[model samples]
Target: MQICVIGCGYVGLVTAVCFAEMGNSVTCIDSNVERISMLQEGRSPIFEPGIEVLLSSNIRGGRLCFSATLDDGALRGAEVVFIAVGTPSAEDGSADISQILSVANELAHKLTQPAIVVCKSTAPVGTACRVQNILDQHCASLQRIGLHRVVSNPEFLKEGAALNDFMRPDRIVIGTDDNQAQQVMHQLYEPFVRNHDRILFMSRRAAEMTKYAANAFLATKISFINEMAAFCDEFAVDVEQVRKGIGADQRIGHHFIYAGCGYGGSCFPKDIRAILHMAGEHNRRMPILEAVEARNQEQKTWPFRALQDQLGEDLSGLTVTIWGLSFKPGTDDIRDAPSRTLIESLLIAGAQIKAFDPIAADNIKRCYPHAVKTGQLQLVDEPYDALQGADALVLVTEWKQFRQPNFSLMRSLMRNPLLLDGRNQYEPALVEREGFVYVGVGRPSTQPVAAALRAVV
Candidate 1:
């Protein structure tokens, strides 16, 4: 199959590379000339693991290429064109699908032959229909009506394991009323789902809704556990124990059950907002989802509030170390990350921050240039180096490298042996046994009884 993937962002890049790896000819197109140039040089603009290797291999095999525009001979003889552009959340919480629309309009003019246009981006419901309408109208004006087909094929790739997710998708949802489009999509995705027929045929709207609902449900689970963690904290109970207790039931699996600072990334936060906006447009009230969003927003502030509670409302002259900056590990994406919320709060309180992440350090440095220039924030090269002379440490993202550390060295490096486990990555008793005061989500620290009583009194 000759495929053209519009947008060299994470999804588009991964999709193009993986398809090319499967022996399909793929040309990835992006408007960003620099990004396309990087891809053409066998370098991935995103921080996904193993993508550049696959991209280089495919390019070497003459199966994959990159271009800056669709008119640059990339769209010639393309059987399937994927609209994988970013649909970021707008100010009103709706998905800003201007990118998708723009691509559709461009394809109307550029595509000289009939092709299946796949909506690979997570857009609002009816987005495929809108794109179809746009293409249909423009094609009619050009006296080539019904020359193209549009399919909703939203991506379900995880950030860290996108390659694996694309190579072995659990299920492939193809949304189109056109039989030809459905068959073509199935043939394209047939290699990924060989064990069984996992290709689900559905209407375009349902497919789009499925993407939002899937992300929204996962976000709801995260917010639900965070809410439970808060309740457990009120009773001095460990949310970990509660999580395990509930997870034992077969009905309730252990996925997304771990209580953390919050859920953040390109998908969950933005998709939830888009769905809520969709509901609002139809005069529908999703109170539960509203609460879920509210809880998540509050959850992101947990580490900041905990720091203030430990070191007083005014954090002036305090030196705090942060363990992670990316929203989660395996990717350098900090969109709506809890570390940003914590950093913002800490900087406002006049606290100096030393942050360390194996891959996200440079990105964080870019985000806080003023603080970095003023010496209020330091993006360190080493994890322990960030702890040097720090008053307390906050574990924001649970990176694999941060799972265990030389606690004795950490104790000696810090000005105060205080720890806030934002991801509940550490055991309270074990950390306290290492001679440090440890506070975790819904976990009580081993504070002195006298100090607790005095505080209560």
Candidate 2:
């Protein structure tokens, strides 16, 4: 298939390269000439694993290419056009689909032959239909009505494992009433799901809602576990144990149930807001989702609150070390990350921050330039280096490097042996044996009974 992807962002780049890896001729188009140039050289603009190799291999095999514009003959002989542009949230919480609409309008004008336009970007309900209407109108203007078909094929790729997710999708949802479009999409995705026929055919609106509902449900699970963790903390119970107790039930299987600072990425936050906006537009109330959003916001402040509860409300002159910056490991995405919230709170409290992440430090530096310039925040090269002279160590992202460490060195290096485990990545008893005060989400620390009581009181 000759495919043209009208975006070189994470989704579009991954989709194009993966399809080309499967032997489809793919041309990924983007307005950013620099980004397109970078892709042309097999350098990924995003931090997804296993993508650059695929890009290089497929490009060498003449199955993949890139373009800066559709009018530059990128749409020539293209059978499928994917509008995989971004739909970041608006100020009112609705998905800003201006990018998708602009791409659709361009394709409608440029597509000289009949093609299947796939709405690969996540958008509000009726967005796919709206794109279809644009194409229909364009065809009507030319008296070549019904020349093109539109299909809603939302992506379900995870950030870290996007290549694997695309290569072996759990399920493929195709939304279209046109039999030709459905068949073409099935043929394109048939290779990925050869082990099973996991293609779900649904209405366009249902497909859009499915994408939003899926993210909202995952966010709800995270917020639910965080709320449970808060409750457990009040009773001196471990949320990990409670998580296991409830997760053992087959009906309530564990996934996204781990108590953490909170979830922050491109999808969950934007989708949650988008769905809530959708509900509001229809004069409906989603109180549960509203609570989920609220809980998540509070959850992001858990580490900061924990610090204040243990140390002092005013963190003046405190040297705090943060052991991660990315929202979650395996990628360098920090959109709405808990670390940001913690850093902001710490900065306002006059705490000197030392943070380290293998890949995310540079991104974090960009976020806190003043702090970096003034030496209030230091993005260190080594994890333990960040702990040098630290008053307390807070684990933010659960990177593999921070999983097992030389605790003896860490304890000796830190000004105070206080470990705030944000991801619940450490066992309290084990860390206590290492001669450090260990605190975790919904887990009691190893503070002296009197000190703990005094702090609680």
Clashes in each model (backbone N, CA, C under 3 Å)? Answer: 0, 0
Please report, in order, the local distance difference test score of every candidate based on alpha carbons. Answer: 0.91, 0.90
TM-score of 1: 0.97
- lDDT for predicted candidate 1 compared with the true structure: 0.91
- Per-residue lDDT of candidate 1, residues 1-457 (tens digit): 9999999988999999999999999999999999988888998888999988998999999999998977779889999999999999999999999999999989988999899999999998889999999999989898889999999999999999999999998888888989899889989999988888888999999999999889989999999999999887666678999999999988999999999899998899998899899999999989989999999999999998898888888898999999999999999988888899999998998999999998888888999899999999999999999999999999999999888999999999999999999999898888999989898988765454345556678
Error of 1 at 284 (Å): 1.1
C-alpha RMSD for every candidate:
1.8, 2.0
Candidate 2 clash figure, as a count: 0
| TM-score, cand. 2 vs. native | 0.97
Model 2: colliding residue pairs: none
Pick the TM-score winner: 1
Residue 115 of model 2, lDDT score = 95
For 1-457, candidate 2 gives per-residue lDDT tens digits of 9999989987999999989998999999999999988988989888888888888999999999998988888999999999999999999999999999898888889999999999999999999999999998988999999998889999999988999999999899999888888899999999999988999999999899899888988899999999998887666778999999999998889888999999998889989999889899999999999999999999999999889877878899999999989888888888888999999999999999999998889889998899999999999999988999998999999998888999999999999998999999988888989999888988765344445577689
